[model samples]
Target: MQNLLSNLKITINEKLYVKDPETSELGRKILKNSIILIDEIGFESFTFKKLGEKIQSNESSIYRYFENKHKLLIYLSSWYWSWIEYNLVFATHNISDSLNKLCISIKIITQNIIDDKNTPHIDESILNRIIISDFSKTLLTKDVDTENKEGFFLVYKRVINRLIDMITEVNPKYPYAKSLASSIVQGALHQHYLKDHFKTITNLSDKDCLSDFYIHMIKKILS
Candidate 1:
């Protein structure tokens, strides 16, 4: 899988950036360091000036790629979902059984992420942490509806749609496939957050992985 992914480029919404960050050395540096910086200080406290300082570039140079930090956050979120969608497709494409395919999809979506050596410019493990912690901020805004119409959240929605198709395949009669699919994706992040900061309310721990809990819950709901 790593070998397969190494050759592919993860696509994000072109509208999210003023320039393609993967196209040039400085652009790639911006992406590479932005992830590290955001992971270190978080989105609220993160700024292009800080990223410029870290990258040893002028703040104006950062703006050449992104209009502002909010757009940059949306770019990162879009890239993360696109990567997940690629992994989902590659991992489940050859599976013949619906249940097994759905189970693997759930695992891929819910399991803790690790750095993929294939993508040297991006640390997916760190990006996953950002997604778990700050992804909702991208959507819980007054601009969400307008952005939704502009297709800003298309990749994320596509991931849920893939799961919805898989759920329907497993049980064609299930009427709440869309609701369940969205819940599994969003709830995985929520559960992970709770496990990290509010442990008393969540059952997930070292002994029980998030994937196992969701898999069990999904199977029960579908049955």
Candidate 2:
């Protein structure tokens, strides 16, 4: 973990992608493994030995990147924030209108149309994985007992706030008085994703229901 963190700092400051490929590879593996580890096994059951076995690396190597389970989760959550930000970078700068930009970006990030011909829709298991190891909630609030000195939380907030800021900037008339609204929107979205049933209904198996509902909701919020 020490070497990986050092490599990250150096890479950031020095702008050298050529350095620390091993550390970089390890980081990628950790991120991928973390998705499965957290979502499938849950946090309590996840272990470095299992992670190492899954990734075909030594337990010591996994330990070298993450000191403990909490650190490992934080690392994965932080990387997830970065991943989403990186994914949306092009969308942020692509359109001139913040409304369109936000709409497009949200579609990309919280994609509807699970059976869409274009994206092939997100896998049910993968969606479960994400919800279980949620990137959004962890970024905003800490579940751990200790105060989060690590500003990885900031990185997560930046993306969410950027979206909200874009919304606020584009729609001056829209009332967004409550800071809690952001969390509300995120929580609503998560509930829609995690639950198998649509609200009180159990027979409705259509996957696009929530996606459509979210689109309508976003449109209502933006308009």
Candidate 3:
């Protein structure tokens, strides 16, 4: 499993980074530690200097891989969605039941993070927290249009597209497959935030309850 995971490369769009962090030891450290630092200190407080101090590298070296914290944030988000797409394909590939496949997809997307020994460097639990809290900041920027042109969001779009395909398969006449897929993804993000900051806003009492909530909502919509 370690060998397979080490071999597995979740590629981010080249446009998102000035240098590919996955290609070098220091680059990998930057990626790994950046995730940790970003989760420790919110993105607004994260900087290459802090990351450099944490990883015992220079800020200029960090800049070689990512032009700025914003680019790094997008790169992280893209890597996450790429990982999700890979798992979605792996998990649902042979399932014949449409609803079952959808349920598995929900589980994969909504379930709380569990660290895989195979990927020792990435603490998915922390990364998931970053995603839930900071993912929107990637697009809620003035450069969103410019970044969109560079395909910085393609991997995320691919995940949504894959989910939309599954939804269409289960309900051919459903007119809002795209909307519903986006809702499921973003809704999960929002609920995670609410669970943490405004508990009463969402009934997602615990991480395990998330999958149940989304699956039930999907069933109601499809019914």
Query: Would you list the C-alpha lDDT of every candidate in the order shown?
Result: 0.93, 0.53, 0.87
lDDT of each residue in 117-191, candidate 1, tens digit only? 888888999999999999999999999999999889999999999999999999999999999999999999999
lDDT of 2: 0.53
Q: Could you tell which candidate, 1 or 3, scores higher by TM-score? A: 1
Q: Higher lDDT: candidate 1 or 3?
A: 1
Ten residues in a row with the worst lDDT in model 3? 1-10
Please give the lDDT score at residue 72 for candidate 2: 54
Worst 10 residues of 1 by lDDT: 200-209
- After the best TM-score superposition of candidate 2, give how far the Cα of residue 133 lies from its true spot, in angstroms: 4.3
Residue 111 of model 1 has an lDDT of: 89
lDDT of 2 at 99: 62
CA shift of 146, model 2, Å: 5.4
Model 3 per-residue lDDT tens digits across residues 1-223:
2354556778788887889988888998998899999988899999889999999988999999988899899988997887778788878878999989999998988888776655666777888899999999998999899889899999988888988998998899999999999999998899888999998767885445889988988899987
**Which 10 consecutive positions of candidate 2 have the poorest summed lDDT?**
9-18
lDDT of 2 by residue, 134-182 (tens): 5444445454323245453555566677767767776766777135335
Q: Is candidate 2 or candidate 3 better by lDDT?
A: 3
Q: Residue 47 in model 2: shift from native, Å?
A: 0.8
Scored against the true structure, residue 124 in model 2 reaches a CA lDDT of 33
